[model samples]
Target: MSIQVAVNGYGTIGKRVADAVALQPDMELIGVGKTRPNHEAELAIENGYPLYAAIEDRIDLFDEAGLELAGTVEEMVEAADIVVDACPSGIGADNKSLYEAHDTPALYQGGEDADLVDVSFNARGNFDEATGADHVRVVSCNTTGLSRLLAPLQEEYGVEKARVTLVRRGGDPAQTGRGPINDILPNPVSLPSHHGPDVNTIFPDLAIDTLGLKVPATLMHTHSVNVTLESTPDADAVRELLDEQTRTFLIPEGAGIDGAGALKEFAMDRGRPRADIWENCIWSESVSVEGSDLYLFQAIHQESDVVPENVDAIRAVLGTADAAESIERTNGTMEIGF
Candidate 1:
């Protein structure tokens, strides 16, 4: 049976989720819910997705913008077998009850509080844990990158502890309304900047602490990560292990890669738009290891990194199929977490 999926808030993440859903053989893109008639609304309609207005008052805007309205958000929720709450952070929190009211399973983005879901998910790390979960939140882009990096170490070498300093993109460049543009802002000067606890939402027993700062970049967020494993592993060996993982790739030093733009350009140069989904762009030259302390820099594509996770989350909640099966179908065609 094809799972009927509805994406709410047709913005960056929502639009990507809708696109991913359309390509899935076992999933049907029922429609999308959005408040305004923006470019996303136009794109959704152009792609033949039925468009539903989230705000009742703006229902006429669809016609004004030359797009057809499928129905209201409530109607979309009632019809869909699964609802992806891709609304902005706080908005998803407010709409939790709506999904429950329709007796439909829901997938939430990382922005929501972890308490809202039965499980928090990172495709590589917590995918097994995501099985049978009713509501799941895909971890934030930063957390997702960190989890993918740590999972291999924890499984192979046994991590003792980890510390990460995040240099976050202020916000999407398009989201220019945000930030101290020319300044470096200490997001959370404290030792653990909600990220460690955010990670705990997925791995309750993980031993990790994180610090973060906001920078003036718009493309991607970078992490300066250090992990103290129970046993030492050579840097080259570590790189080899990481390269073996589908979601990671060691950025070659000779590539002249410096920032998110370089990584995106690298992917585009090879005809990839999302640039191999889980390949979160690890810097080859930046990898370092001293004794048990392993350090590296990884770029997290804030807009695109988490898209596949949403797709996997839908499959997890619906349980109509296994993740591996869904991933196999999406491979090469859709870029299954790189």
Candidate 2:
């Protein structure tokens, strides 16, 4: 039998997750919960997903917008084997009790506090940790990118410490109201940004420091990463290792894929859904090592990179598949990597 899944908060991540879940052979997307009857709500309906009202009082709002509601969010939770909380930051914490009342296993997005989940998950890094857990959090897109790179290095050469500079997009393309439209702002204005701490939630003992800046771009978030490893490996060897990872797409030179714009175009050319690139785009030429230091540049599709991880998390939490099995199934079904 397929695991019944409900997605709450059908906005950015929620919508993508719902679609991904529907593609999984072992999962059934029961419905999607939304608080408003926006374009996304309409899209969900168009996509044939049953739409449930997240706010009971807002039920009439969706009805008035010419959309039908399946039921209330609570009812959706009750019917599902698991609920993926794609609600905005802090909202998942509020929904925790509702899921608990129904004894439904819930998976949360990275936006939620790590404490809200029994396990902070990255399928490639810690899939086994989430097995049979009541709640699991798929870490943020940035953390997912970092974890993908760090996991392989840590296992092969042992990471002593990592430093990353994150160039974050001010907002998703649809988020027109968000700013830094013409300026670069030192986000958080704090030393060692929260991202490092967020990564630590998944790998508690790993040492990482991240600095963040919000740029005007809305397309993708690029990362400049440096890791001090316990053992020095040749740059070519490092590239070979990263290439072997299923979710890492090493961008070779002469491919003419220079930036996020080109990468998006490439995805579009490949007929990807919403031109989504589910893998980490690492610059092959940028892979460098000096003594014990390893450095590289990678771009993360903030909206889509986490999509596959969410799929894998479902399998992990359900104990339906091991990490490799889940990742293979997800990547193959979704056409994740190039």
Candidate 3:
């Protein structure tokens, strides 16, 4: 029997998770919960996904929109084996009670506080940490990218310390309300952004510091990564190692993929769904080692990177598969590699 999955929140991440879950051979997308009957809800229905009214009062609104809901969100949760809470920011924390009421495990996004769950998950960094947990949070986009890159480094050549400068997209392409429409600002303007501590949630002992900048573009997030390794390895070796990682897509030299815009274009040309690039696009030429210091530039597609992680977290919470098996299946099922 397939694992029955329910997605609560049919927005950016939620919709993507639902689509991914639908593609998983061992998982069944029971239904998706939506608070509004906006375009996404319509898209869900058009895609043949069963939609549920997330807010009881909003059922009338959905009806007004000429949309049919299978049931209430509570009813969907009750029937689900696992729920992916992709609600915005603090909303997931608020929905915890509902999931708990039915003894259904939930996976939350990074927007919530660290204490919201005992585990902040990245399939590459800490899939085992989420095994059988009641609530698991897939870390945020930048954190997810960092974790994916750092995991292999931490394993192959012990990371003495990691420092990253995140050139973040001010908003997702569809988030027209979000801004800095013409300016770049130091988001938080503080040293060691929350990402370092967030990373600690996964690799507790690893030392990492992150800085953030919000740029005007909505294409993707670019990371200027510097890590001090315990041992020195040539760039080629590091490239070869990262190349082996299923989720990290190393951009080869002279691929004409100069930046995020071109990368998005490349993804579109490859016929990627929603122009999503789930892998961390590392500049293969940027993989450099100066003695024990290594530096690289990588672009992260914030919108889709965590889609696979959420899928893996479902299996982890159920203890259904080990990290390797689950990751391989997810990558294969989703066609994750470049």
Per-residue CA lDDT of candidate 3, range 1-338, in tens? 99999999999999999999999999999999999999999999999999999889889999999999999999999999999999999999999999999999999999999899978899999898898899899999889999999999999999999999999999998889998878889987978789999999999999999999998999999999999999999999999999999999999899998999999999999999999999999999889999899999999998999999999999998999999999999999999998
lDDT per model vs. reference: 0.82, 0.94, 0.94
lDDT (tens digit, per residue) of candidate 1 on 1-338: 68899999889899888888888888899999999998888888888989999989898877888888989999999999989989999899888888889987788898888888889987777776677676889988888888778888889898899898999999886897888678888888767798899877766777998989998888788899899889988888888888877777788878788888887777777776544344667887888889889999998888877877788777777665575765566554475432
**Backbone clash tally (model 3):** 0
Candidate 3 all-Cα RMSD: 0.8
Q: Give candidate 1 regions above 4 Å deviation.
A: 274-278, 336-338
From the highest lDDT down, the ranking of the candidates is: 3, 2, 1
Instruction: Give, for candidate 2, the lowest lDDT window spanning 10 residues.
Output: 108-117
lDDT of 1: 0.82
Which runs in model 3 stand beyond 4 Å of their true positions?
A: none
TM-score of each predicted structure versus truth: 0.95, 0.98, 0.99
Estimate candidate 3's alpha-carbon lDDT, on a 0 to 1 scale. Answer: 0.94
lDDT score of residue 181 within candidate 2: 77
